[model samples]
Target: MNCRGRVSPGTAAPTEERSCSWLNPWVFFVSALVIKTAFVTVCLVVFLHGSDGQYKTLLQNATEWRCIPSMSAGKKESWTCCPKGWKRFQKSCYYLPADKMSWAESEQNCTGMGSHLAVITSEAEQEFLYNLAKGAATNAYETKYYIGLSASGNGQWQWVDQTPYEKAATFWKPGEPNLLFAEKCAAIHIKGKTDSNTYSNWNNILCFTSCYRICEQAVKVV
Candidate 1:
């Protein structure tokens, strides 16, 4: 309608109303973005405050635990260092002796020291160790690593911590355990030569048959 109360003549009212409808969608979008940003900001503030003391404690503990949503039942769990002389990694701890021992002998030594040969669990754990061994050893390229608990005895392999075997998670070089007449302990694949990748396969080579071992223990996280 005209300001003078005369009936309006312009026919643009319908177009203006149609254009205004788009405003609602844009408003909704902007509102959602603001809400999300606020939520993230709040979370960051809380975490920064809450985690301030955590990193220091974890450093002392020499271990860490990351919550695996898929592997998690509800909340995250904790794992700490089993002892001194052990390298702490995420959730678990490891030991690479100053002097090497035969795999079986290594197992017994680790047991005596309240630990066992390392057990490979998650791919993260695998990579953690793969990198670890590579960094610490001059011969990582050619050295085979030992893990605790092999299918060695009774065809029943168990973690030193006695965690489930989790058969589905075992990463073995194919044709392995050929059980080859009871040469039963497990060893990481290694080649006598260097290559771009740590070959996760074997080539007629077997356990060091000499010594050098890595051990592990579950931190009795109280």
Candidate 2:
């Protein structure tokens, strides 16, 4: 007897579709992308002071949640603790080089922070600062810049605090700081023995002057 017409028992049509048959990998991938986009959008909106995410509450008082950058609190791009308007010089911060200013005005610029215009105590320190003053080379018009030191208060050669001019005693032109009645302001002068030291006159001095200013209390780590 031939069995050609009889169908096999084991092989048959597939059962009804799975309950989650539509959840293919590609479908899941598109769904995941959409969810991620929505989450990010919600975060940005909250950050920009949109719906306060507390949709359940009726009152909509704004809330602030700031996120700081990854840098340490005290440290910034190049210098540490640098505030606006100050440029970093060596380890300390300095004001931008400005034209001649009266001693009182200069004092005000530095007073709030307990820092003052630069002052040099030693010959070596002087050279070091002069070189610093020549920074970047373009806008450097003067080899000498004003510092915080002054004998302004007592009419005696001294640092800002009335300390005697001690350090490596500053060198001066023979007749410098003639202390002319009107010549209270100090300016550097060429110290060639032949040249007269006139307080009213200015020069590209080849020698340092005793009447110069020096800054106290530098703000830098050793």
Q: Considering every candidate listed, which one attains the maximal lDDT?
A: 1
Off by over 4 Å in 2: 1-96, 135-144, 152-154, 187-217, 220-222
Residue 190, model 2, lDDT: 28
Instruction: Give per-model CA RMSD.
Output: 18.2, 16.8
TM-score of each: 0.52, 0.40
Candidate 1 C-alpha lDDT tens digits along 1-222:
112223368743443222345467778999999999999999877765674444443344433443322233685664343465577776667777767666778788888766678877777777667666655566553766667645534666666667788857766666655654466566655544353344343221234465556777655442
Winning model by TM-score? 1
Candidate 2 clashes between residue pairs 3 or more apart in a chain or in different chains: 118-215, 119-214, 119-215
Q: Tens-digit lDDT track for model 2 on 67-170?
A: 12234469753213333445444445555334434555555556644567554455555545444444422333333445544444445555554546663456
> How far is 189's C-alpha from truth in model 1 (Å)?
3.0
